[model samples]
Target chain A: DAGITQSPRHKVTETGTPVTLRCHQTENHRYMYWYRQDPGHGLRLIHYSYGVKDTDKGEVSDGYSVSRSKTEDFLLTLESATSSQTSVYFCAISESFRAEGYTFGSGTRLTVV
Target chain B: AQSVTQLDSQVPVFEEAPVELRCNYSSSVSVYLFWYVQYPNQGLQLLLKYLSGSTLVKGINGFEAEFNKSQTSFHLRKPSVHISDTAEYFCAVWNTGNQFYFGTGTSLTVIP
Candidate 1:
């Protein structure tokens, strides 16, 4: 939370419009993740970056894309925002896969109308 | 692949009472377990983690969890919970994979 920050803490967007959420970390963690939280679904991992330009899709990565050109930044982009995509999105950072735990950002609340 | 399940969706407890949140995971390989807490409209915070040895792990806010590999359970406990502990608790597992699997979460309510 202290080292990771997500931009546009709150956002309202129209359907079919592309939206991008940015996550920046000062701790220089090697791992970064994007997750979406919803009712009953908990936190679903959208995507994760292991290093610069090295990313992988998570369980729910169909409509989302991510990029990590820099170690300090990981961005999640929705191809076309939909009502189902309206949820609280969180960004987390970890030094390694077996590190202590993840440090999460405040989160971005997105509303699609 | 790894998956986590939180047995209880909600648990209501009186202040100063002891409480436990149950969690079980399904992973073929060795696993790393963790517990997280989330307040309203906030991100999840690390409560505790079980990376390797020592089955019993203590976390912040007087929270502790025990890792039972036999039953594949990692249950969180607090001898005396406070009102401030009222929040949503999540149990997660991360194997040697690309991402961590999280449970639906358990809503813990502390009554005064």
Candidate 2:
């Protein structure tokens, strides 16, 4: 809510398609993360970046990839969207890995047909 | 090597009723606990956090949580809940690796 902004508040795309969601932060937080919210899974980490050109996979990172080319932007791309990939995606940022907590963006709701 | 347990999937209570949501971590001798509330379509907002001192941590929206190291539990409590409090509550902990782990989440339905 603070300095974080998620692009494409809502989107609907067909299966087997590719989609990209963006998370932009004005706080220059050193750590950025991508999380997906599902009905029964709560929020699961998808990918995270510790610095520019540095990223790591999350628990559910099979269908997703992330990139951090700069300090303020983290991109989440679904190479091939599927029914199971349809969920609300949230972007969170923190100053460091040991931050007490994170500041989350409003979130992007994506639907796949 | 860290995980969280919500224990409850859903909790129903009438308006102005007291409710408690249970959260536990696995074999964690030390942890940073946090509670976040998600209302409807809004993004999650931090309710409270327990970093150190004061086992009882009070947060916004009249929500509070107690961190019990012996039990590895951090349970959220509110004396009286309102319809507005009918939302998804998540308990999270930062492990030694500095990665965050979240519980399955407890959906609180405040019946009018």
Candidate 3:
């Protein structure tokens, strides 16, 4: 409800395929983050962007890559998807460093077989 | 580095019963604390946050949390709960800069 949208709400793909998930925000927030949710894992940060063309890796960034070419758009790409990468991906936007709360997108459920 | 711990994996309570969710954090420097809730098939929503000031913080849906510096804990509580209150709760911590960490989460089920 924070004007955040994630494309391809649900996807099922075979292993070794390429997949890209899109997160678009109308709020133009300065900070954007990508996270993956798995059973018993809560949510693990995959990657994040501070601004356009500025990105940083998170704790679980091994199998994923991210790009933020525009302020409102942050993209997450899986070069070659694997069965282990199957999880619910969420995008979050925050206005400030630690003051305001984050606004999260609905989420994208990806299943790899 | 900052980390959060939610002790309970799942909690079940009858309707109108009081419930508590325990949360603890560890950080060398000062940190901000937050609580988030997620209903089924929905994204996480901010329940409440402790930035500064009073140790006790009240959030939406009749939920409240207490931030204890000495204890390194931020426990969430509600006096009465409804069946609609069944959901997953998360505890989070953030440092001065940009990184944010979340706990494993606790699933609360309100039984009738």
Compose the digit string of candidate 2's lDDT tens values, residues A66-104: 999999999999999999999999999989787475898
lDDT of 1 by residue, A1-93 (tens): 698889999999999999999999999899999999987878998999999999998889999999999999999999999999999999999
Candidate 3: residue A69 lDDT (0-100): 93
Q: TM-scores across all candidates?
A: 0.95, 0.95, 0.96
Write one digit per residue (lDDT tens) for candidate 2, span B1-112: 6888999999999999999999999966667899999988878899999999999999998999999998999999999999889999999987767678899899999999
Stretches > 4 Å off in candidate 1: none
Q: Which prediction has more favorable DockQ, 1 or 3?
A: 3
Q: Provide per-model DockQ scores.
A: 0.64, 0.74, 0.68
1 or 3, greater by TM-score: 3
Instruction: Please tell me which predicted candidate would have the highest TM-score against the true structure.
Output: 3
lDDT of 1 by residue, B1-112 (tens): 6778899999999999999999999874778889999998788999989888889999999999999988999999999999999999999887776457899999999999
Worst 10 residues of 1 chain B by lDDT: B92-101
RMSD in Å for all candidates: 1.4, 1.3, 1.2
Candidate 3 C-alpha lDDT tens digits along A4-108: 999889999999999999999999789999999998888999998989999999999998999999999999999999999999999999886554659999899
Where does candidate 1 clash, by residue pair?
A: none
Q: For every candidate, what share of the true interface contacts is present? A: 0.57, 0.65, 0.62
lDDT of each: 0.92, 0.92, 0.92
